[model samples]
Target: MGYEWLALAAAFLWAISSLISVTPARHLGPFSYSRWRMGCTAVMLTIMALIVGGWGSVSTAHVMPMVLSGLIGIFIGDTALFACMNRMGPRQAGLLFSCHAVFSAILGYWLFNETWHLAEIIGATLVFSGVVTAIFFGRKGSDNNDWEALHGKLAIGVALGLLAALCQALGGIIAKPVMQTDINPIAASAIRMITAFAAHSLFWASGAKLAKSKNPINRKIFSITALNGFLAMAVGMTLILYALQDGNVGMVALLSSTTPIMVLPLLWFITKQRPNHYAWFGAILAVIGTGLIVS
Candidate 1:
């Protein structure tokens, strides 16, 4: 598959993994849950890298950038995202997370001299508009679903979500040059996971209150956390890195930002509640926009 398809695949995995992560993330708290996820994903990627002799592809030149990418992306971005999710639930959080596409596009233009065609720009706008429509107008006023519940200050949640988006964009941009090298994506992903895991380990060791778990760890929670790590970080992230190897950072980010659209159907299936017409309309817009982007 092309890089665009790879990015979309990553989006799909993230959509599934994000849904799986909600329960455990809420239980363990964002910081604790993020730490656990990084650790789990680190081990998984390290093993895969070793098994495939992918580590040999990594060079000293790639280390610093990958480390920076991990710290910015997984260490800060992911934790902020889950915290946003804790406050606003998946639907709203997903919309906010999708803002990374725009952030990445801007950053790519500024930092890497990347430019998108007019068609791509319009496509990106439509995708973003669809996200806004789906998130704001998709839910019914009468729907008192748990996913609709707001846990904390809406302002704080929105800030965190945007912060997550910016950091994620920065992370990808920082890694773009390294991805152009001969390094294996799996190896690059492993470095990122290990670096993030190490950062989380240090934070936990600092005995910060945020590092404490809100609920006791149970087998179910552990399983869910591990599964989320596998799909989201291990597989999903690897796919993104692979796409970044050849694709423009902005385009890859835009394609992957479709996670929100992908999540709607999964959300409907899990909640047994169909989305309103706005959701379908938004999905159509996003699909058409994606076609424009890749055409």
Candidate 2:
């Protein structure tokens, strides 16, 4: 499969996971949900690595990058993202999250000398434009353009969302050199998950953030959390590594940044209601832009 498909699959899988996750995230609080999810993923991936001989290829060199990737991307990035999604709905959060592509492109060029074409730039622009359109006009009522409807907490939420994007972008770039050496993407993802879980554990151990943890006791809720972790970390992050292995990092970010676009219809489906007019338009534009970039 092409990297574009991998990126798209990553986006869709994330969207599905997000749809399932928001409720638990709200109940457990973002950090708690993130920490536990990473823990689950760490265990699952560790088992996977043992099964697939991913451990044999590990080197001292790979360890640092994998850990850093996990810390930046999963620990910081996902924690902040879950908080942002809870503070602000996914609609606004998605638009802000698109900034990851720009951050990734700039960092990729500066750090790794990744280059882009005119067509790629155009496609990226369209993708962002579609995301904006969807977000601005896709809400249930006339309240579109979240950037315009700013308030005290909402503004903070937006900042958190942007921070999450930046971390995610940086994490992706940081892991690139290691992955380029032909490391198994699953192993790479698993290693990152372990490192991120370790980081989260340290944070919780500090006794300050423990107040934020809800400590899920319900088996069903725990199951949901595990499932989300498996989808996002096991499946989604692995696909992300696979995409970054050979795909233009910028294009991959832009293409996969369509999570918000995918989420609108998902929200409608879950809510049993029709999405707003602009959502459909934004979805189409995002698809067209992604297709163009691939072409």
Candidate 3:
């Protein structure tokens, strides 16, 4: 029971990462930022894995699945999420990303032959309704803070956010079977981060237009980006996997999906303005919906 709290802690760290990432993600652009973040995280995980002898648990058979997971989850999912955050701000992006719980549940039902009762269906509905409500009515006209302002088209942000959520769902599905084995979660995470970093590096070397950074990385931005990587991927993700080792999957997902709600006060503290009623209501609705599904 106490171990389940790891999921909540992970959610809190992720909320903080969202705040820390805004500047770097905005400055470097999503693709470049993700590349740098993955590289930093890969190094950190690799060192940690070595220190703990976590690599002993890994096998050649686990490589491909981990690669796929990293490609879909870290490479695409993470980039899309930050891109969405760059446009819609962390509050909206976080809410949309929380839909990963719904996506994960649906995918689990389909792929694992897991049966869902009526509660899950209602939960899914509430999650969707919450997302819609928050996106449409989350902000007041008086909220003119840059963090609350939309950077680009709302439609693009919404699409990117949903894409990130779907990719996250797919990533988890791909990794679940492999994770049931005795492989070390730290080593597993290291492999995924390395795979993602390679993918990002390759993309950058190919000179893709979108891969270009909006501004050159400076010490300040690099430090913040590295810290974001450490918090979000190295620690935050590892915590979720650790919790999943002992906690119920549904319960873990339900707890972790509360990142949006957890970010509200952090947003208020930083921005010096409370989120509107719609924001609070929508976040609560989504969490409640997740509770019903996982309960």
Q: Which candidate tops TM-score?
A: 1
Q: What would the TM-scores of all predictions be?
A: 0.97, 0.93, 0.89
C-alpha RMSD for every candidate: 1.1, 2.7, 2.8
Clashes of each: 0, 0, 0
Which lDDT values do the candidates have, in the order given? 0.92, 0.83, 0.83
Q: Write the per-residue lDDT of candidate 3 for residues 183-214, one digit (tens) a residue.
A: 89999999889999999999999999999999
The CA lDDT at 116 in model 2 is 78
**Residue 181, model 2, lDDT:** 86
Q: Flag clash pairs in model 2.
A: none
Q: Give Cα distance to truth, residue 244, candidate 1, Å.
A: 0.6
Q: In angstroms, what RMSD does candidate 1 have relative to the true structure?
A: 1.1
lDDT per residue (tens digit) for residues 82-124 in model 1: 9999988888898899999989998988988998889988998
| Model 3: residue 179 alpha-carbon error in angstroms | 1.2
In candidate 1, the residue pairs with backbone N, CA or C atoms under 3 Å apart (3 or more residues apart, or in different chains) clash, namely none
Model 3 bad stretches (over 4 Å)? 1-3, 115-136, 246-251, 281-295
Query: Residue 100 deviation, candidate 2, in Å?
Result: 0.6
Screening candidate 3 with a backbone cut-off below 3 angstroms (N, C-alpha, C), the clashing residue pairs are none
Q: What is the lDDT of residue 159 in candidate 2?
A: 89
